[model samples]
Target chain A: MSIQDEFSFINQIKPTTVHHEKTLITGIGDDAAVYIPSPNQSQIICTDTLVEEIHFTSQTMSPFQIGYKALAVNISDIAAMGGNPLYYLVSIAIPSSWSEQDLIEIYAGMSELANSHRVDLIGGDTVSSKDSLMITVTVIGETEEGRQLLRSHAKSGDVVFVTGTIGDSSAGLELLLSKGRHGTFNSNEDFLIKRHQYPNPQVKIGRFLSKLKRVSLNDISDGLASESNELAEASQVTITLNANLIPLSKELVSCDSEGAIEKALFGGEDFELVGTMSMDEWESIQQDGRLQNLIKIGTVSSGKPEVLLQLENELITLEKKGYNHFKK
Target chain B: MSIQDEFSFINQIKPTTVHHEKTLITGIGDDAAVYIPSPNQSQIICTDTLVEEIHFTSQTMSPFQIGYKALAVNISDIAAMGGNPLYYLVSIAIPSSWSEQDLIEIYAGMSELANSHRVDLIGGDTVSSKDSLMITVTVIGETEEGRQLLRSHAKSGDVVFVTGTIGDSSAGLELLLSKGRHGTFNSNEDFLIKRHQYPNPQVKIGRFLSKLKRVSLNDISDGLASESNELAEASQVTITLNANLIPLSKELVSCDSEGAIEKALFGGEDFELVGTMSMDEWESIQQDGRLQNLIKIGTVSSGKPEVLLQLENELITLEKKGYNHFKK
Candidate 1:
């Protein structure tokens, strides 16, 4: 469709999450979304940016996939905080050599994920570049009264828990890079490939945990150890992890123990929920089966973060863990 | 101040404005800006991107200025539609070349303007770029009920008007490129320099125009001729410009008439609002002393967009008379 048609079509994905803030009159489809004010809820805001070579390899993923992932990652952040995904603004820069089909695919991919997440694409910026492609997605989400979860909320003695499986994404990335072709892997491993390339966000789980049921929470995009470190840093509490308990993929079992453990601990883009719950609440959820692999790996502590690897009789500091975005 | 201190401290300015629609929940602050939604208002959305070596040269403007302009241009789109300036989301990709100090200054510039406009910065994406630097800003604004203007609203027999002057930015750019470090120009003329370096988005004027006072509206960023043509195409109406009525800079007056007219008609980045207004409303606004230089420049007609010259005495179709980001 034409550019005008695309915009008109986008207009239909207006948000349904009713707003209590009196200031915001129009959210997505205007020159600027209007906001009056609501004394009831204090707004929380954040922003991020991605570049062509830095965030993704245009060699591996399509522009559309890149576009979708850009927003998906941001949405994961809001979900980690137990917030409802409301709307998002996007900004893109493409090189002159790129085709119109490339742009169409990019927006189409973003629109696809955005529609599924029910987050409206409100507005953004597009400009031509002499360099590589760049995409940025900014999301707005809301938390109900007294339900917002933060990294700082993990009190000492709170049980550390994670939802769903981890290391699948990192493993998938290794497979994609090493194998090059998807067909070379076991077709059952197709699921792993998808996890790394197209991570499905757990918004519903986030919402569930936001009910003050969890003392703290974080999305596992930057691997478990990295996020755990973040929780510890923000909460100013020490965390000790039972490295033996951290979940790994069946594929990881075939791999070397050291490799499997490393991936589970530090390979990024897991998109799983790493959270903290009071000892009682953690027990309740484990019995509920609503969360498949929800396991208690350790506890909040007054001392520094430590990884107790029973097999090796080792205790490693949080800094010894793998790579993080801000880390050198 | 240290980079970290500047980054945190820049978030303090929060100016407030009275005019707004009903859909904005929270502007600025938090993880992302919130928008409410008013079904009566048709949301208009647009996005643009800027990259290093493509949009600006660091030699001409500081990184802070670049950051501020990146946001200001996006907001200008909202202004063009006559909408209220609300909060915006930002996405930035930086290369290793930049120091932490550089990032702080860049953000400081953006925060400075956002505070003045009462626009909150909600959320964005940041990633390492392997190549060039990029900054993208997405602004959301609102228009009142029954007042949202569109580029497709012009009708035959309507008078065309433009807010503020045009062509100053192109002139400023010319001076900047020359590296005339010691010379000074008019304070009013300096407006051109700032206009080129930091074009102002007319938020209040846009809010006023989107209130149905005008039949059609667009911002003059890609030159007047291009915008005129866009309105004509969108509205299915013809636009005719009176050669004498176009705004000219003092720098332009010193140049040959042909060169002056070239910049006046086709030079981009003026960031002025161009619109079609009914005869009566046009007269009233003209009589108001506050909007005096807001001049009548043309008229809508039944044919295609045509440029008229007193000497030629005939209509000439203006073809390829403006800047195209792709072509540039």
Candidate 2:
């Protein structure tokens, strides 16, 4: 379909109302979307872009998976900041060769995710591109006063924790590369593929954590090592992580035919939350029934900003950090 | 530079803070940028994307101009909603062929615009694309509660008006295509080229119109006919535009060597504001010396939503509407 026709197609399928956010004054069909923030709430904003080959490929991901993961990444950023996901704007660049069915499925995937999160897909722009498909999603979320988390708030002696599993996405991608989409897998292998294809951003846990005082947070998209370095740099502290304490799913552990710890440290695209909090704060949150599995894997120290990995009886500084865009 | 290194480059140059607004609780260096909206204010959000060959080519635009125009387009969306431009998130897909200098210049151009508007560039994600450069800018603006304009609120019998000239960008593109970059031009030709390269979003005018009690507003990105059609369709009223009343820049008038009226009617990317207001509202606005040039080009009448162009002695329905993405 032509760009104009694609817009009309989008309008036909676009959701008109969000589940509960009545603050949307006007959505879609206009110059921009207008919305009101709830009383005494702060807005948290973030954006992420996914390029065809750079972020995903047709072999490993369907059109629906592409759309689903594109929004998932940005929502992860909001989740890391301890905000409730509310609205998202998607900008897509479509090559002429892409079928109408492909575009429809992409939107359908996004619609499904939006419905699950109660986040409105308010407005977007569509344009033609000469190359592969590219999608950019910007998420707007809200947090009550003084509840938002920041990367620059990690305090000395604070404990570091990560939600869900680390390195599963990287392992999943590895398996997909070797086996292709049609490869048969048992439940363990299927879990890895699912983890890579559909990352669940920890929004609920993030919101719950935001209400507690004195916590620093970030999402691990660029691997745990890179994110930890960023947190240390932002907070002007050093993060010392115990490799043994890092959480690994049973599927990932069993699939560690290669360097699993290395993947956990430096591989990218894991949409899990990593954060730091004082022992008291962490203990208080642990009391909540929902956070029983929150893993304490490290501690923040008063030192030059950096990330240090502690293995059995030895501490090593990782020279090769997470995936760098310019590095081959 | 790798993506992480590119981020550091962005940080070295990104604006530290906006001029007056301190609602930014945190900027950049975070999982997501957090900001508090001012009391009784509604957030107006919009996004626009520009692809290399689709939006502009190196033959017609410089990296600086591309960066400037990308943000300018999003600002126009905010202006259309009658909101004050505040913060923006930029997600760019840079091809490997682009030099670090080219990327730096792009950010410099965006920084120039952001500084002028006092809009903060809080955060963004950068990724590698194998093909062309892509930019997606999402703008966040604010206005007093209930003050923002909407495309759906135009009342029947309201007067339709537009700010500034129309069709200059389309005409400018035509000139650039025929003349090439080195072609000589007088003041008028230069003005057209400038118009095409850098559109000044009507932020001040939009804010003024937004403060008014009753107004329906939109920006003319697609031609006058297309935008009018959208307004008519949105407000559920017929919009009758008088061709003679449509305002044209002096440069556009003299430069229209062929079918200037057609360009004014159906050309795209004018970046001017087209809105509708009641007679009393128009009269009150016209009384202000600042709004003396706001021209009444059309009227909203009770009928099926459509746009009718009044010519010399007859009315012509615009069958060839605005620029459609997919249509040739």
Candidate 3:
């Protein structure tokens, strides 16, 4: 866009509400956004990128969904660190094929999620791309001093738990990508598609986990097997996941059972929190009404850093088989 | 690249030194980076993006220069705000055509600049693109409490000054783009090309100016005319520029005088600081040995927001005629 058009578009989408008004010295319009930090808190930061054709396509997602997912993924990274997301910056490269209206809709989708979480839109960059549209969001968050969770804190005998269901997004992606080939969409297919398009970050659960002692957490963006391996390697422990105990959404389970299991293990983009905590802490979470969906899926043991899956009659090592952009 | 390859690349380029070690709680390894903020300081955040073909071509720049310039522009934004850059995140989309070695060279360029500024490379995202490569960097900086320069702070009776020579980058770009049409590269041509490829951010001068009262500052990334108009509009004042006083590098003046003046007025990507301050403060800057290159360029007056040029023979209204990505 022309510089004038770019500025006008920025003004049009400028945030109306700032969650931490007292701390925010300045927002958009300046060369850089300025803000103060609470003395009692530590800062958390993470960034994620989404590229058209590589991450998603018009056939798979609308502009709104694409924008929402872009910010959602970054927020999930913050959530994994057990931080409360406060502000975010978006840098987008717009292809000439896209219109200003489409960009506005994308911002709308992001604003909806940002508003819900009271996260402020602080600063960003807008540029023109040649062939594909791309967005990269960096989220700034905070946590109480020394309270942020880490992937390296899991201990032997800690119980591993996952929030909500796994593999629904992968199944949803499958349904969306093969809609015409599959006859017609059913209610289950619709549910899975929504799961794929509108995956939510488990911020509340992450914060709760952070309040507990010695918990290791990671966001499940790279499939169960891959995330489990990361947690294991980071913590220097062996993680054993029970195949039967893994939570699968009803929509995902309604599909072929073997395929569902495979997807649950190796499919990605779930955006759920998977963590390990002491058994005592797990008991406390069990009694909390707000954490009813938290499911016990595995255990951390002191050994060589690796991930293993326990099937009905057999046990096997799980490979890091999640999506890889340049595997070929 | 595959996830493993991406991780290995991250490890290869991970920062070896962190300037503010006490404030950094974590860097580059977990779900997100964590840091502590000093109670006496405010944070500055900015992001910038560079796209292949649109922002740079292989013919005009090497991968290393592209990477260095990407981070330099974002640092310039922080410098314009008079803040000390502390940390940064890079989100890059690499095309299949680029080699891993090329990516490493890009990182090397960025690391050289980053290390000089003592900025930590905390986190980033690396993904695959189908065609063009892109890089977006988000830099976080800090400044003393309530001590930030802004575009809206200029007042009537203020004298405007710009540090260093202007339009050298523009002239350099012209030389590089028309090298074959002209004769082989001369020393002056080489010097101009270097100016285009290696623009410096005026952090020290910006900090010096920030110590003064009520200074309005901007970086001349989008040429003098466009940036002057922005300052005038933002500060709600009319600015009159003395055309002869605008500093031009000797190398730039060696070329066509009229063309050099035009490029100085309308060319972009000359990352020099421009600001307005009281006459007393300007005198103080003049007395400082480190600020000898600062030049008085214009005066701010209370009037309708507009920018004007004071030519030797006739005065005329200056147009905002800078580069716009989508003007066509």
DockQ of each: 0.31, 0.74, 0.70
Cα shift from native, residue B74, model 3 (Å): 0.5
User: Residue-wise lDDT of candidate 1 within A144-236, one digit each (tens)?
Assistant: 645667776788779888877678777777776776533477754666767777877778888888765656887887678777877787677
Alpha-carbon shift of residue B317 in model 2 (angstroms): 0.5
Deviation in angstroms for A42 in model 3?
0.9
Q: What is the lDDT of residue A102 in candidate 3?
A: 83
Looking at model 3, the pairs that clash are: none
- Candidate achieving the largest lDDT: 3
The clash numbers for all candidates, in the given order, read: 56, 6, 0
Per-residue C-alpha lDDT of model 3 across residues A1-328, encoded as one tens digit per residue: 3244677788998998888899998898888999998788999999999999888888788889988899899999999999999999999999988888788888998998998889999999888999999999999999999998999999999999999789989888887778632347888888888888887988998888888888899999989998888899899999999999999888888875669888888898999988899988788767775555689999989999999999988989998878766662
List the candidates' TM-scores in order. Answer: 0.81, 0.96, 0.97
Which wins on DockQ, candidate 1 or candidate 2?
2
- Candidate 2 CAPRI-style tier: medium
Candidate 3's C-alpha runs over 4 A off are A1-4, A180-184, A287-292, B1-4, B180-184, B287-292
Docking class of 3: medium
Per residue, candidate 3 scores C-alpha lDDT tens digits across B293-314 of 6889999999999899998988
Task: Summing lDDT over every window of 10 consecutive residues in candidate 1 chain B, give the lowest-scoring window.
Answer: B1-10
Which segments of candidate 2 are over 4 A away from where they belong?
A: A1-4, A287-290, B1-4, B287-290
Q: Is candidate 1 or candidate 3 better by DockQ?
A: 3
Worst 10 residues of 2 chain B by lDDT: B1-10
